[model samples]
Target: MKVAVSVLGLAAIAAAHGYHEEDQTPIEGPHNALWYNTLPGDGGTQADSVFSGISTFGRIQYHPCLTSRSVKYDIAFIGAPFDTGTSYRPGARFGPSGIRQGSRRLNLYLPLCSRRVGFSGGYNVPLKANPFNSWAKVIDCGDIPVTSYDNGYALQQIEDGHNLLLSRAPYTDADKPGPAKKDRTLPRLITLGGDHTITLPLLRSINREYGPVSVIHFDSHLDTWKPKVFGGSPSQQASINHGTYFFHAAQEGLLANDSNIHAGIRTTLSGPSDYENDGYCGFQIVEAREIDKIGTDGIIKKIRERVGTEKPVYLSIDIDTLDPAFAPATGTPETGGWTTRELRTIIRGLEGINLIAADIVEVAPAYDTNAELTTMAAADTLYEVMTLMVKKGPLSGMKEKEERLELKA
Candidate 1:
């Protein structure tokens, strides 16, 4: 995937030399203070260009806990902060904090022009112009608070929080009596993630609101295994377990078209007939070797065709989808898998599609060293998605300007 460069001219200069400087400015101001560090100097045109009058990065203002409307954002960043569903390494619950701490260093202003052309030998195209200049808004609502002991309750809380954001509450008549009533748009929930299973509840809530949602699930395992069957009633235990999310989703009628739920499944452990029957049930299964054979563009095209352009898409990325060489510490690292670049290419290709929400899950920081690869990859992916959102409009304006400049030349 082509990594879009940050707009700060100074960082461009610094990056040329392979060093990322940490900006130490306090974040108590209106916008994130780290953004100011990307400037050419302490005070420069680059700094002014990226941070001028931008009160916040995304929906998250500095010191979010102190804010009254806790859910104040077009996009909310809730953390599941749990890994109880993992069939393997038990530390993915720490993923949210680790990713957050690592991501705090990001400036969040991606200049579309910085994207490298011909990244996939012309398979991928750069945005026609820079979108950051167009003023699209995003907010980082605080992470969802999860209790350590009760996984089921924690999952319910996550669903409740997302529902609050998704539900449109009436504007208080006491504040402003209205002969005129306007429906407030609910925030688009972007979860930081606890485990892959955390997605089940989030998906359930989304399905309730919008009907079946098309899922683009990226993972090493099939996650379609049926949890061990118990007497009479199906156990809720298996319903929300990490490995069985997709299976449960399918069984529960949460998926619009089973084919729309493309599973980029590479690794696996065999269990029941249901697990093996995923491909039969309409999932567009793209195995690891298939990704290697056809490349990112092929897989992206397949996804686009299956999901279609108009449908609201939900992206769920399990950190283990990446090759262990690049993201070694994920709960279930497969030996061979897609490179981080490949994943980015696939994500970038979905630029114009209606992406309602996304999440990066199952990152176990305890298994990582330096936390360098996973952090960098996760942050870059978020930037790419945000840029995609911007490029759909404001960023396109910049592209138009670039075209005019080229014509003049």
Candidate 2:
């Protein structure tokens, strides 16, 4: 009797809302009109509020570039959610999602005054341009599926995912004239890393296309430590870690000699010999305190002179490069690092350099504060990178390399 009374009560509640078992569909009412959804759909418009949609990097449109051959994109944001290579901390696997969540306000609605002036896309006042409004077809490719149990498999997955995007033809619109002249142009990838170790596989994938590109590594530690000094293991796979991945990269010929550089380094090395070994691994150091003596422009000049403008360059940014006060949620936080604003200015100063690919890693959001400072810094730095790519357009070396191969044939 009690169960029957409960069923009757549910039926009464449903009847109050005008429900019928046979209808099976919503009844059209004034409140149920489609016109209520004045916000923009996923068709790439700024009508929706920043808080009201699926989270993507800067609320950009998402496409599965790995599985779809028809999908065209010039610059794709991919997430590498593996952090097994971390030595000190282990929560960087969550870095990718954390960075995305912090990027909610990046491309929000335009300002009232700017809208009156006939501006449409989201704008960065410092950059003086809107990357989303640029000609490069940009999309978020989601995250790479990596297994956490085995480091080797996870690293291989990163390399494969990066290579797949690199193999796709760049999206081009005939109405909008871009920097690429070739019919078959490769796309640039902006990777959200799981850890600093992820750079090894990324560089390996980049080597297949650009052939040992110069690396502009921004970190607080000299990641080029030899395996013996970093750590040793019986298993060869276990030996390749975040602190020693650059040594492996050098061994595999994935780095261009005399062109790579490390900026903002201030870690206490094992000894002075570590610096000598670092030089042997092909990286010139720019200490963290050099900013006081030379300033940002001076450091930028040094990096520009090191990598130059002709060869392909890969940028690897470890979030620990920023001081802990600015970004505390990293696997390896070092004191006396650069500020977020200073890093943005330095990245913007690198405009017109041949940046083929880039990654920002080591953002372990578990250690972050309530303000989400670390993730916000990583996202805004990524914004600067995207803006830099838009300002420079596509790499011209893609056409030149293909022509060289054709000549050999």
Candidate 3:
């Protein structure tokens, strides 16, 4: 009787939640939801069909499920909407929504109609190149339901949610390998930010998968300040904060500090100890002004040298890494930053960094202008990350030497 009742209850719940598509097509996509979804149901305006088809990235479908029994996922995009950790500004809670909204207006193809830089296809239905199939399964898992009434609980919830995704299998049986293996091999996580503080919890979850991964952080601030909670300060107790989580993560052995590096740092220091604090936390600094001296290729060479192709890596991009002229909607804006194209080229140069996971953070839409360049840059940056994950080979020769080894093997 209990088993029968349980089945009935589950069936009822699924029925209540299922989309009752009467004549809706069962399939769509060149990029999984691309071409077929464009025409959605017959007899609608172009605008209507575009918006109504798929509500996620560039008309991609929204998929909120993350269970072993469900279809495996290669990449899962989700949002973290809590920004109580912000020290200077607080509107980043809207970052994820802003990014998604901006992405809908952007095309998925390399140049909207060519595959020279990316995949070959028209703007509406983008295709992928050889070995990096456009058919790769990416699911938008939706936002973590963080209400922010309790900060600690909210942080833990984010960590738990991330761990849950990392622990599951990708949709392909080949990706999973063995039926007995509890977790899949190559599925990755792309997170849209609540704030930089989310990185600490995210790293904690990832540590369980590949211990102490080297980090390639692109930010305008060092983010290694010590929290007031340390040393048992007589003032009110402090918690893990955006400005201080990297310090804690390093102290807790959560990062391969010696191998980690920060790019585009230009924030004013509180004291001489600020740079020292960052050094102690285990990161090499690449100042924003250094870009002019070293140029894009120099910066790429330095990053590849610091985070060699051997170890697993994580990329944390704060929107402020781009100059305010390019991305002005971040909470902590800093001057003298890289251009969006420069950043894109640098990221592209890191084709074989063994990137395990990544997140684009600190995009506050409230501060943006009607142009929406800040959020749009964040969306474009996310696209660069996806390309980095799914690319086949270098554009020309002069590839990283380690890649030659990979090809030979």
Candidate 4:
């Protein structure tokens, strides 16, 4: 009788605590169930919570763009998880996952005063837009299945994987017109890369879709090094490293002649002839020191003049483009590079250019601080890139703050 009374008392306490053993009760009213239990695009899979659900770039919806032919996206965040091409650091193979993890706080629906506020997808005040909330259908397509044993095979995998995603027709939207290359309205890929070498394969893949596209290469090193100068001869694998991939790309006729530009270059070269060789590969250099002499707007103007606003441009950013103080976790750590703000400002200035595809590469999270500074910087830089894309093309019809302020004036 005492045990039975104890059990009844426990049941009463459980009830008081709002515990239900046989509870299959449907959630009622305007509660968190709408945010937690529903799928993405409905209420979202609670990925917006930042602490919950699968980690994707910006907590965006995930789609198997590589495996499924039916899945279409206007902007797909694909990962190239191959870092065997790195000469100085090896941990960048984990860059794709690290970048995604760092991007968790992005695209969040804020919870305030124990109540969900008006739906806002992590707005960018400077750009006056939220890319996640934009009309473009953006999704994280996950990482490429790249091999680690052989660099040659791994590069091919990256090429094929990028091509697979790039070839897919974009999700149809009226306000978001897909960038056109050869009469086909194709999707854009914002790639999270393993290392700088991945850009070569990506360029090869993009060349198929858009032909010889102009390149906006951002790094502390000129990647257009000759095979023999960087590493080669005995092993061909040694030739096509992160330092020399752009050389291969140029040789393959994948780059637009005289239209490609490399900004933030500060690496110690073999000689002045290296710059000549870089010119032969069709890339104009904007040295890192130029930032001090000319400033961000000047650098932006130079890039705009070089690549032009008309042609399809591939934007490739190595994390080392930022100073080691800002982004220390990279294959190559160059001290005197642009700050994240300067880089973002330059990227934002390229608002009117035709950007077909882009990648943020060489983010080795293993070398990052406990705060994940490098990883966060990389993700935020990509966010800026995404904003640029969101504002361009058909979406450019929207008026900017400058335009609105001018009207008031």
TM-score computed on alpha carbons, candidate 4: 0.84
Question: Which lDDT values do the candidates have, in the order given?
Answer: 0.61, 0.81, 0.71, 0.81
Writing each residue's lDDT as its tens digit, candidate 2 over 241-357 gives 899899999999999899999999999976788788788778999998999999999999999999987667899999999999999999988899999999999999898787888
lDDT of 1 by residue, 70-176 (tens): 43443446667778877677887777766765554345343323222101010013544232223344555566677767778888877776666554322112122
- Cα lDDT tens digits for candidate 3, 1-409: 6644654554465346541234112222344323222122422111223334455654455776543336456677888887888878888889988898777654433212111112212121122332223546666787877767776788888888888887666554434232112332646788999899899889988887667879999999888877763333233224577877788789889899699999988988767777886788779998888888889989999999999976678999999999999998998898889999998888877877777789999999999999989988998778777766655222111123435667999
Instruction: State each model's C-alpha RMSD to the native.
Output: 10.6, 12.1, 12.7, 9.6
What residue pairs clash in candidate 3, if any at all? 29-34, 72-170, 72-171, 73-171
Of 2 and 3, the candidate ahead on TM-score is 2
Ranking by TM-score: 4, 2, 3, 1
Rank the models by lDDT, top first: 2, 4, 3, 1
- Cα lDDT of model 4 by residue, 1-409, tens digit: 6644655565566567554544312212234455542112334222234576688998888988788989988789999988888778888989999999888877665432111122335667788777886778899999989989998999999999999888867774423333345356677899998999999999999988778989999999998888887766358888998999988898999998999899999999767887887788888899999999899999999999999876678999999999999998999898999999999898888888888899999999999999999999999999999988887843223223234556989
Candidate 1 is scored at a TM of 0.71
Best model per TM-score: 4
